[model samples]
Target: MEALKDYLPHSVEGKNILITGGTTGIGRATALLLARLGANVMITGLDEQHLKDALKDLYKEAKGEVYDVIADLSTEEGVNATFRTADSHFDKLDILINNAALPAGKVENGSYSEWQRVINTNLLAYTACTAQALERMKGDGHIVNIGSMSADVREETGSIYVATKSGIQGFSEALRKEVNKSGIKVTLIEPGAVDTDMQDQPTQEKKEKVENLEMLTADDIAISVLYCLSQPKRCDVVELKVRPHLQII
Candidate 1:
């Protein structure tokens, strides 16, 4: 694979971006990259300490302004607060990265509350945030939805997670068509097993498989986000599916 620096472009300079779940993993990685590329960035997360620590790191390397909002996307109030924070931080938004998500075990193993948590964070929040962003965006804007390859592979214990991703795919498609005439572009990124805190609870067999296959890193997916945003306004990258070469599914 080519180095991420090789794909870096200056198209993102001066852009204002908001990323969900930016305290860690793919969202954090993307926020850092966009900051370095001169985009004003605001990230939202539920943890106060994590958000503070992430801001320190972001400010250290960011060429543009960096901000963080503490909000849990699982609730409607939290989702609304995030956009309010973004509006206060940036003059206008150029990109919205819907990367916040929660993983659930099996359908039968999880309770109604657990199912609602995953669904709200993974699927509902994405739509809600996009709607608010659309209202704030002027003529042109980009919406990047971070999905999962599980939507296609559909693992046995990933029913809830896969369902949310499938919904993301459908939502991205319909939203793209609905807003394309207004100069807003929608892109969905589906990534396979990424090495992040999200995988900390994997089973022994799953861990071994990830180690053997050499799973993709959070930065890998972040680079894909840059590529999507770097595209010309006339050309929209509809969907990008990235996976490790050794990954079977």
Candidate 2:
């Protein structure tokens, strides 16, 4: 049971994977995780320096093929160009991880600009990227959306981030029905507060404060991605939510 808990027939040794927002957080974590599993990983983000650093980290972890495409996922043109660049190299994408996301940054006193930026980057960008991705992927492809607890529970606030995240959940549900016959699976990964920059400065004390709990790590999320990809094509992994035990209501 232990060996088969995450044991599936599919392997990432030669699969072509495209991860958006691959510079930081879960996206970066997935890139390294997939690379280590022998997949040819391609990442996209706006930060050139960060991208370079992530590639280096990927090599250190996997020592294999890792490609980086520079593009802001916030705009239609950027999303389109990213797909074009990736398609030029790989004809089909076995896995597409829409992990690229931005935080809602202090919504209490935030203005409309902040809300719009969050919506554009986190919500619209994901839709645009997925559109271009579907055009290239044919059969048995996998799509994983890095969703949030805010989407399921009360929207975090400001209605900007919350609305966008809610869209991800809705899209995943609709996409599953639409693509069921197409052999493509759409899954939503809703995780609780991570010990990353997304939660602001998540220090050791803060991490320790939550006892009897399992704080979700980037690697943990990446492992979930790997697990889903490892499953047999006939099997489907739908919505999965990870919350630490100490996360009090």
Candidate 3:
């Protein structure tokens, strides 16, 4: 923790960062933290109100710049529009965090349309946003992809969600290898059962479901995001899997 606080802004201050699904939950938490730490943050979500709400507390704590883009992010146009919105606000970019995602669907008996919706939102849009962000990156940048434990575990309820997340892990790994020479780092941040909208907070019963460990707050995941970006330029924190201590994966 002292190292993190001391390393502080090796080059982070005034850096422009893009975060998808930043309206609420983990994305929002990460955005606020980066902003407080002196980075210029741009966030995207479908809800303008939620975006405002997310910024409410952050605005109070920080003095850095932050922008919000209202984008559906499930369609090609939405993805493009989000990039455009960020481009309009900032001239250069440094970080791209793919934090937005879609819900899971039952694959076996699910409708084809439902499957397409899930894949299109989770898989296709992530690709589109990454490509567009890369095009706008001024120099070497960071791409932090939020992946899932469900990708490796049994996502009995969310089969499609699991598939895309698994594919995301692969995509990030391949992209990291391809871009390593450029000094651009691509990392997959796989977290399990965070206390966010993507997963409900543990009920009294669910909390009891685990013995000693507590649930993961969005801030916990935010710290992980910071840790990745805080690494020295020559070293990359490629893949970080953060699960509650009691939940062994």
Clash totals for all candidate models: 0, 0, 0
Ranking of candidates on lDDT, top first: 1, 3, 2
* Model 1: ten consecutive residues of lowest lDDT: 1-10
Better of 2 and 3 by lDDT: 3
Per-residue alpha-carbon lDDT of candidate 2 for residues 1-249, written as tens digits (9 for 90 to 100): 446644632378888999998888889988887788778889998889898889889878874578888987777888888888897788798888998888773467678877776777888887787777777778678889999888867654535667788899998899889887888888889888777667765478546644446567777788887777777667788998878776654
Q: What is the C-alpha RMSD of each candidate to the true structure, in Å?
A: 3.3, 2.6, 2.5
Model 3 residue 120 lDDT? 80
Candidate 2, residue 3: the lDDT equals: 67
Which consecutive 10 residues in model 3 have the weakest lDDT in total?
205-214
TM-score of each: 0.92, 0.90, 0.91
Error of 3 at 248 (Å): 1.6
Reference-based lDDT, each prediction: 0.89, 0.79, 0.82
CA lDDT for candidate 1: 0.89
